[model samples]
Target: MSEPPVSYKRHRFPPQIIAHAVWLYFRFPLSLRLVEKLLLERGIVVSYETVRVWAHKFGPDYVRCLRRKKPSRQDIWHLDEVVVTINSEKRYLWRAVDQDGYVLDEIVQIRRDTRAAKRLLERLLCKQGCPPKRMITDKLGSYGAARRKIMPKVEHCQHKGLNNRAENSHVPIRKRERAMQGFRSWSGLQRFVETFPAVRNHVVPPHSHRSAFATHLHRLAAMAEWKSVTLTAA
Candidate 1:
C-alpha cells in the first residue's frame, strides 16, 4: 500500500518554506538561529525557535520519503563508534556505513561492549534485510565477539588501517556537534544523527573524484528529488 501524504494543513507558512527551513538546518551544520537569520534576510520573518520546531516536527517525515541504501550481498560494511559528551556524561554513538560512504544505520548507547555491538549489528540486519559480504572495523574486541555470535559466516576484518571509511564518516557529525556546541541528551543526539546523515548522504554524492560537471548534475538531481519527496507546494 502507498503511504499517506504528509499533511501541512494548519501551518501559516507554505510547505516549501517549512521544508526549506528543515533542509537548511540538516543539509548543513548551520545553527537554528543561522537558519532564522537567512530566512529573515529574505523577508520570511521567522524565529529560531520556530525553525527548531519545524526541524523536529518535519525532519522525520522527510527522512521517511528519502531513498535508503539497498541491501546487497556484495556490500562491505564498516562499523565504528565514537564518544559523544552529553550533559557531562559520555555516551557512545555507534554507526555503520557501506563501502560507498553511505550511512546504513546508527545508534546511541551508554555502553561500548559486546552487547552494544550486537545491538548495532541486529539493527543493521533488520534494516538491510541481510548480512553484508564482509564487515570491517578497528581493533575492537567487542566487534569480533558480536560478529562471531551474530554473523558467524561473514568475513570480519579487524584492523585500524583498513577501517578509514568508517572513521572518516564520523568527521561530519563531529563538525555538527561542535557547531551546535554539543548535544544535550542522548535522545536529542539520536534524533539529530537520524536526520542529519540521511540528508547529507542524499545531497552529497559519495564519489570523491567526480568531475565538477558531474557533481553539479548530481546535486541538481538531489535538489529535485528533495523537493518532490518533501511535497514542495509552490
Candidate 2:
C-alpha cells in the first residue's frame, strides 16, 4: 500500500486553517503577529509563532505548485538589480521578468558585480531552460559582461530607460520593506523574494488588457489553483 496524496497527518489544525494563515502572510505584507490577529478576528485562534512555522513549512510547497502551473514565460526578458539593506548591511536583489510582467526568477547576493550577474543569468537559464530571444536591462556594465560570458548568442539591449517593467516591479518590495521595517537576515529575505513573486503572479491580472468577464474568469482560475495547492497541510 502507498501513502495517500492528501495527508494532514499529526496536524491539530485542519488544512483550511493552516493554509489560510500561510496565505495571509505571503499574499500581503502582513507580519506573523498581524496574521494571527486577523485570524483571531475570524474566530480562529492561532499564535504568531504558529503562523511563522506554517509559513516556513508550507510557503515553499505552495510556491512549487504555483510555479508548475504558470504559463510559459515570454521570450523577451527584463532584468534589473537594486541595492537593498538587510540587517543594515547592503545587498543586491536581481530580478528577471518576462515581457508580459511574469516574474521569471529572483535572487539576492552581496555584490552587484559580474559574479552576481552571472549567478542571476545561470538561474534564468536553468529555470527557463534556454536563453531568452531578447533580454533588456539597465546600462549595467556587469550585466553586459556576464551576458557576453554566459549567453553570448542571445540579443542583449543595455539601456537604462527601457526596463520599466523590471523597475516598476520593485515598488512592491519597497512597500513590503516599509510594512516590515526591514529584513533581519539575508536567508529570510532570499526565501521571501524567491516565493513571494509566485504568489503575486498567481493573483495579479493584466487588467489593462483583460475585460471584466475575462478578469473574473482569470481570478476564478487563480483561486482554484491556490486551493488545489494549499489545501494540502504540511
Candidate 3:
C-alpha cells in the first residue's frame, strides 16, 4: 500500500511573534540575542540561536515566496557596491534595488573591480531576465565597463548625487550588520543580504490606492498561495 501523505503545519508562534521577530531584525537593527530577550519578556522562551536559524532559513524563503505571488514592477535599477569587513578582511558587497526601494539582487565578492562588477550585473540580469531601462551608478569606472559589455543599450548614468538612491538603500543593511556583530564570512554576508531584500519588500506596501488593511489582506492571500505552490512543487 502507498504511504499516507505527510502533513506540514505552519509554525505555532503566534503571527505576532513571527511578525515581531522579523520586524525587530529588519527594522530596528537588533541582534538575534536581543530579539530573543525581548520575546522572553513577552513570555516566549525561544532561544537566540533559534532566532538566528529562523532568520537565516525562513526569512529569505518567506520574502521570495511573497514576491513570487505578488511581484513588484520596477523598470529602473540602481546598483552600487559597499565594502564590508568579514573575518577582519575587507570584502565587497554588491547591491541592486529599484527606484521604489525594492531589492533586486545582492552578492559578495573578494574584489571590487570590473570583473566583480560584471559578475554581479550578469547574475542580476539572469535572475531578472532583462536589463532595466536605465541603470544608475556612481563615478565608478568599473560600472561603466560592466554596463558597456553586458547592457550596452541600457542607459548608464553617472553623475554626482544621481546614485544616492542606491547608496541610501544600504543604510538599513549597515544598521543590521552592526547589530549582528558584522558577518563572519562572505557566504554568510551574501545569504543574509539576499534574504534581507525580500523581507524588507514584504513590509512595504506598493504605492497604490489600497488601504493598509487591504494591503495586509492581499499579502496574507499571497502568502497562502505561495505555501500551496511550494508544497506541491516539493
Best TM-score among the predictions, by candidate number: 1
Q: Which stretches of candidate 2 lie over 4 Å from their true place?
A: 1-7, 67-74, 232-234
Model 3 over residues 1-234: C-alpha lDDT tens digits?
432332325776654466557556655678888999999998999988877766675566555545432223347788898889877899888998777667788888888899998998899788887778888998889999998999899888887598787898889889888888887778777777876777666555554588878988967765554444334332
Alpha carbon deviation, residue 85, candidate 2 (Å):
0.9
Worst 10 residues of 3 by lDDT: 65-74
lDDT of each: 0.91, 0.83, 0.74
How many backbone collisions does model 2 have? 0
Candidates in order, TM-scores: namely 0.97, 0.91, 0.78
TM-score ranking of the models? 1, 2, 3
lDDT of 1 at 15: 92
Root mean square deviation (Cα) for candidate 1: 1.2
Clashes of each: 0, 0, 0
The candidate with the higher TM-score, 2 or 3, is 2
Cα lDDT, model 2, residue 204? 81
What pairs collide in candidate 3? none
Candidate 2 structure quality by residue, lDDT tens digits, 89-123: 89889999887787888898889899999999999
